[model samples]
Target: MPPQPSLSFTLPSIHDNTKLDCRIYQPYHSNPSNPSIPPYSSSSDPSWPRHAAVVAHPYAPLGGSYDDPVVHLVASTLLDLGFVVATFNFRGASSSSGRTSWTSKPERADYMSVTGFLVYYMHYLTAPQNHARSIEEDNNSPPILLFAGYSYGAMVTLQLPPIDSFLSHFASPATHTAFADIRLRAQHLAEEQSTMSADPASPRKSLGMRFGGDEDLSPRSRGKHRAHSPDPEEKIRRGVKDILSRSKFIHRRHHSPSADRGTERNIEVPCLENVDNLIRFRPAYLLVSPPLGFVTNLATMSFSNLWPKKRKDGRTKNLEDYTKREESEVETEAKLTANPTLVIYGDHDSFLSIRKMRDWATKLSNVEGSRFRYVEVLTAGHFWIEHGVSQELREAVYSFSAGLVKS
Candidate 1:
């Protein structure tokens, strides 16, 4: 089948105020009268797909982009399942602004900005103000948002800021100045990290493994590796400590403006109830071959560890501060446990070994609710380049999404 037509646009990253290239892949709708040509709609059409998705590409340094094969595969799968998919280039990748950071902290702004744009777009389309003919004629409801990321992108997605908090902050006037401050802090981090040789500039060098279709591992091998793997709890604890230490610097720079300035600004900004209405759409997250070690380490870390501290007196806090506080009150795993989430990886995955994948499954399985599940495709590598593996991944994701409706 031919690829669906995608609308291209640029979104300013909240981190550095840099313009990031983005594309929205609208689901295919048949043109009955003119079968030879593809159907097109400039506004919301009832016949068009309802749910929307924002998919993050894999690691940028390793040739990952909005155009990556896996990204397209997932986007296409979601589109086939009746969704409008949005994909974008992360910082330092393609034409996006600023260099990539070692951790997922900086990408928080990028993810939140893209999410905010979609939420606001949906709100506008559904609002009575939009005069688009198709929308007025059809009166279709808005799309539900889904956030899916692969590999390094998954790491960033796992650490995404709280949605309500992000929306509140985005709706505030201090957003620009806050973003400017984040940009400066990011620039400083980029300068500091540039001197270090720790960052991996590329994916694994097993060219034959990645492309030759000969590196697939067996389920037995995966089981043996899992049996021999070290206890995940200690490693998780150590990782959390290290991540907290590293994230301290990032949090210190996220300070909000004074209470008086914020109060004065809040009067001009939309009310809390209004902001909530604007962002009524919530998102379900899917992680494909996420590096378990990285995800688990940061997933449980509190927002207080990465967000600026507020004074004891409630007056010192603003919407952003309160949002951060609200997020800090809950554990990341607890939040995901409350929502629909899926984690998929391969027995022979390059990014996350089978043993680590098992570890994540075990850890997340302990969550109170059965809101999380995982699928392991046998003989498939991290990238799912082998024949039929991508399809299996798609089916897994689709099934998970379908299950979401049932729950």
Candidate 2:
């Protein structure tokens, strides 16, 4: 048979009604009817057992977008590694709508929207009610989801704290207050634009908060909140942890010898039964060249610089507390030391000082389990424009991904 095609489509900017350009690179397969192959019916319905990886581009204001060569390279490599890859242009980048913001708030919404789309698509293809038809395929397991990025995109990737966080957020409509905030922000921005415009007759456009094509993201029914309940964010975090525990039980039960193996592909059916844990999507993250100094050190120093008068009085105590906190955090970090992360940089990177990069690398290397690796490409700079440098970078990424498969 002929080759299956890659899919391109649009999703509305979660921050506004503008359509964002997105593409899905279909997995390459020699046997379409193989029991392991995920069946692709529509862009929304992909049925099969395969993992997915989404690549976010670099800083948009500096001309980054889905079309960036680095982004395409990573997507292509992931596809070769048997991952269903997705890449998209962020707001005001290339063909996407709205201008990129300095604070990166709007870009976060764009990332969340893309992630929401991927989760919905997974549910559509794998869930019983949305399945096109069932086949007597092998006992194929669900695909693992992976997230990878370069530079600024890598920064976004690192901000996520493990895949379990997503599993919690997606479990139910009641837990998605953050999404509701996005919709409200979108509406408020639209109203502000309307007031400033000269023409009043022009109709206002609104993007509906829909998940899985038909179901509204907003909670359909209301329940009374307990007077002693924690804040909304904390509640959602707890909800996700609880859902994962229950989902794990369902997973063990479905895998029992007496259960129907073929039918267990609809395993998420149990998760959907509980109104809160309705979505069954999770992704692991691979971040490259995240700016540690920019995110952490600068903030720590900003206060000291702003209030020099108070610095001397508090310096000793502050240093003591900071050291204690770091020591405690290191103890916790021991638990995740086995979770490997690879950090690659050019020796002459323009965006990072040699001292800062070296210090970061040293710290990563000292982690107990040694799951962190630091590699410096000789004489190369920030963007890797030097001759053959891009290829070297690609090899490093591909090696890291291949290692994940083996481990």
Candidate 3:
């Protein structure tokens, strides 16, 4: 069977309205002709597993983009395991519009926007009317969401708000806003894809094939290719405007006097309510070559409290206060320990010492009821360039994802 094509789109950053390039790959089920491929379909089978993943690349200033080799490796591995995978360019990376921030707050918001889109997309795609009934009557399992990252990206992922907090922004977004538009767009595209998946002969005019050269091409080469081909960015901008206009129309109709009089009620309420119910998910995390020590501090620009400071009363405050994390941070840590998480790093990493990484892993693993696990590859560097390191990395990712699906 031919490889499934990816759907490329642009989403606005909640921080500054910058356009971020994004792609989503659908999972492929095996064909009868090919027995080697596994049989799994999130679209057709109501009982089939429903899983989605969002992978963030390394730092932008260090030449990171959605096309990074490691990012692609992780995405492909997840895709093979029946995951609907998503990858995106952070601000100032590749075709995305903006400059990298000194502090990583804006970048964090960028990740949040993409994550929100995927959540709603999967919700609408999997929650058919029959599926909804089965969920309530048969007590079917909820979907799974995995938030994975590499290097500097992992550092940012670790600092993200809790799952419920991250999803609350979409529960009741205002009309005509970016959040509202994202919800609408996700529903529209998901419905379209679901229809196509149901009918195998349907023509996929919008989806483009993903070639090996496209995935491995350098950023410079990609720019040159974009210069020659028809522009997708402009087409995406027009689509965004259409969705925004549609949202405005829906808002007006929903607020009209007839709507309140029980004559012209909103049509989307039923679907949105079902999506709300389907929002319950088992969260998972995957961190590959996560940065540590000074590299982490540099990536997050968090040097302010690195040293002790004198108190206003002329007494030096205890340094322990600095180590005390905020409530959100504490909540994030709790979620990680409570759920399945996989951390993979190399012993010969250049950016961080092995001792520091080992200590960090040991501390997290020692926590009571911690499901966190780590794998240290021998002679592997930060980039996983050692001879057999990439294979080992892929195996670890596959094992972690398979376990989640089976459980």
Could you tally the backbone clashes for each prediction? Answer: 0, 7, 0
lDDT of 3: 0.73
Return the top candidate by lDDT: 3
Query: Which is the better candidate, 2 or 3, if ranked by lDDT?
Result: 3
Cα lDDT computed for each candidate against the true fold: 0.59, 0.53, 0.73
In what order do the candidates fall by lDDT, top score first?
3, 1, 2
Give the per-residue Cα lDDT of candidate 2 at 35. Answer: 28
Residue 265 displacement in candidate 3 (angstroms): 28
* lDDT of candidate 1 over 1-407, digit per residue (tens): 21533344455677767656666554545432233333223233445444677899877777878778888778777766666667778887886767776555667678877776666545443333344433443653334578889887776787785577776655533323543222222222222222121223422111100110111237787566457764433333343344334432311223335567554221232111222244255468898888766444454354555655566765444456557745743556665676677888889876665786797677786767757777889989988898899889989987876655333
**Ranked candidates (TM-score, high to low):** 3, 1, 2
> What tens-digit string does per-residue lDDT give for candidate 3 at 235-289?
4445455655554332222433363555654533211222445556678999998
lDDT of 2 by residue, 1-407 (tens): 11222444456655564556666555544343242444233222343344677888887778888777777777777766666676877787876768866555466667766665565544433344333323322233234566667777766655544555443444432222444322222223222222322233424211111111111113432122323334433433343455444532221123423366554342222322232212333344565555555543342233433332435556665566568648744642442244556667788777677688788678767966667666788887867788998788879878977776555
